[model samples]
Target: MGKGILIHLQDVNESKKSSKLDIWLDEERENLLCDITSLVKIESVAQEEDPTSDEPFGSECKKALDQFLYISRRDKMESYNHDGYCASAIIGSSNKTKPEIGIWNHLDVVPVGSGWTYPPLKCTIKDGYVIGRGVQDNKGPAMAVHYAMKYCLQQDLIKNIRVRQILGCQEESGMRDVKHYLENEKAPNYSFVADCGFPVCCGEKGHYNVTFKSRNYFSRFKELSAGTAANMIPDEATAVLVTEQGEKTYQCRGIGGHAAFPPGSKNAIGMLAAKLKKVIGRDKNYLDLLEFLYRTASDGYGRKLGIACEDELSGKLTCNAGILKLEQGKTILSLDIRYPITVSGASIKKQLYSEADKSGFDIIKEEDDPPYYMNEKSPFVQTLMSAWKEETGQNDEPFVMGGGTYARKIPNAIGFGPGQDRDFSVLGLSEGHGNCHSADEAESVDNIQKAVKIYVNALVKLDQWVGKGMVNNENI
Candidate 1:
């Protein structure tokens, strides 16, 4: 199989003017599969309770970090473990100077929920797909960049440019890994996070998570819980309500999807809340809260709350009632809102507070991250665009996304893709791959291979452009 891959590599090298990146990826396909599979099996789900002095995120996250660093060291690369928050592997110049380009990805995945044709932790390669949690959301893309660096190292393609691949272990949770790395290490002059879709993601909407809680709410509900993560639309929710005759149990079922794109998903939390309201009547304070959610939960544009807004660049604001729980006699609802680039967090918050006050709920906690954007005509974007068009023969323009990535955290950084918009149509899979925080997450091997090619070419082009002094890091 190895020899066959090499033969394909040689054939492509002989036939094409472009670099043999695609062929080299084909050659290393099995190795790529092995690397991602091995990393996936470690179950690197970040747990707040598992933090220690050595492992800030958790022991499982630390284990995943250790495994990644071990692979880097084995590949004869300079690697560092940053107190377990994140890890970095460097190829090219060994100088302590700043790196010219940075490739960022996350290693930690969201908690694997129930329902799957295969175990979520074990990598299952079947019919040209790599199925498992974190395969697409991050781990696979990270490995793709890793192997791209390996290709550059073997070909001695490292000239004046140095590439740093930083892998974080807590992206799905709170992105503290990258946060820790940036504090201890110098930020890359320019970076691209491999955590979005193809073409290029030049704009990302503001991310705000708001929690509504009230202890004074009148409720006959004894216990209720739904959703495992705040960024995912709840698929299943259950409530045990106190009734006049006897205690009653209720459940709501809906399709789960990424909170960023919530239009198609039927939020289970919202559904259950509506069901409870119907049974318990609308006069209760708890029902009022549920009533607000049930009315606006499915509206991605924030219309029912009077905060509906949109702009040409990033489109409309979206909101998802991601989590619902009854604890300590207080009913809590966690909302994940991705607002348009034009809207201010303050504006959104004011409207939300107004609605919450009217509904008799208090805003217990609110966290806001401003939107991130780069002018489409910048040298950085153009460089990546050229590489993408050259490799794919498509001239699609760079666009905005609702999903926030490390791009929002790093200066002049943007989200590039290992997956494309057409991936579903091409591969015959549904949006979010029926995984992405849902059960049985999987990423296509073919998509990973294509992304490897694009990354290699982009790195080569970026190195050349930076070496020629085309990009001014200070201005960028």
Candidate 2:
């Protein structure tokens, strides 16, 4: 029942430089940049063990929310933190009956991991780019949403609706932050997360995190450690190989990157795991497992290890041996696999365990994300696609991606804007140049403006549904 309305700016040139709400937004750009740069200073990486019973990531993430709330309050808007979890700020017209609209963005970012020209905690502006952690992934988009909403509220341009910007603190590791918010707070009517790429992201492939445990294999080894994060391909993995002789250590080196493009960087744990067979010659079974993994990496047809799957949306299955350790004669392996949309993680795990059983390697599932897909003609896709075209005269269709985002957490969610084709080329974001989660990762100023424009237009187009009362109660 949602309707779409298109509004072309009176002067595409001037409006492109400055929309109807431009003057207010233009005045606030410097302040907006300062707020986003400040948020990037907090390290909100998810951690397993807590220094105390209190959540560390949650508290660190709260600092970001506090900074944002401070900025919003200065902008003359009411803002508050949701139980030290997510943060919300709202602005609307006198139309109290206007349907509620939500612009969701997460403040928590992936670990600043390693290898950076500048300190990950410090935001540096150079060559017209803001370089730091969380610059691209969510912080940049979060700022864009902030500016868009601020402009609407200040100019009183939004009609017949209230818009809210929700900032989640635990989106990188999981949806626990948002989950807690939903349990204690009211849900939005219509929402879109600016957490993925543009022109549009109509489909996101399934994601699964499974820990394959093998026990009674290497009891002599006292300890083993590999990766700190599941989403990042481990750059270093060390194993304390033990036998009747003594414990020998083997260290593997590589670069950590998103699993989507794993070939550019080696999986250190994977390499070390493969070398385990060579280091411990008597363990022929472990050797076979190594051979299976190597063969799968070389060719996609390795069935002896149960680590292969094929699909069209995201192409083939990608497996990263992120964590491995041998203890109490038991080998534990955590494999992060992102499968294509057509395949199920359950089926993939079944095949893997079947092979492992034959080879005497026990395996188990740790996490799984069901496949998500949407047609280009679907309302979500078309609306975002139209926004992209309105901002830029290109008609690029929605596409799928291997990397997971908050879009996977919410039903019917799609990734929109903050990345443009020119920005891709200018910033050298053309696949494997190191942008997101990489050292010196930053966002371009031009892209920031383009993103603000796109988001504002999308919000406007979504207003029709709000006006019609079709989206007010729809849980997005």
Instruction: Specify the highest-lDDT model's number.
Output: 1
True-vs-predicted CA distance for residue 429, candidate 1, Å: 7.5
Q: List, residue by residue over 411-472, the lDDT tens digit for candidate 1.
A: 77998888764343443554334557766677778888888878877777666555555445
Q: Candidate 1: which stretches are off by over 4 Å?
A: 1-19, 49-52, 421-435, 469-472
| Reference-based TM-score, model 2 | 0.84
Per-model RMSD to reference: 5.4, 4.0
Q: Across residues 7-107, which tens digit of lDDT does each residue of candidate 2 receive? A: 33222453543545556566767877888889899887755434233344556776787888888888877687787667888887556556666678888
* Per-prediction TM-score: 0.92, 0.84
How does candidate 2 score on lDDT?
0.68
lDDT of 1 at 50: 36
> Cα miss at 409, model 1 (Å)?
1.1
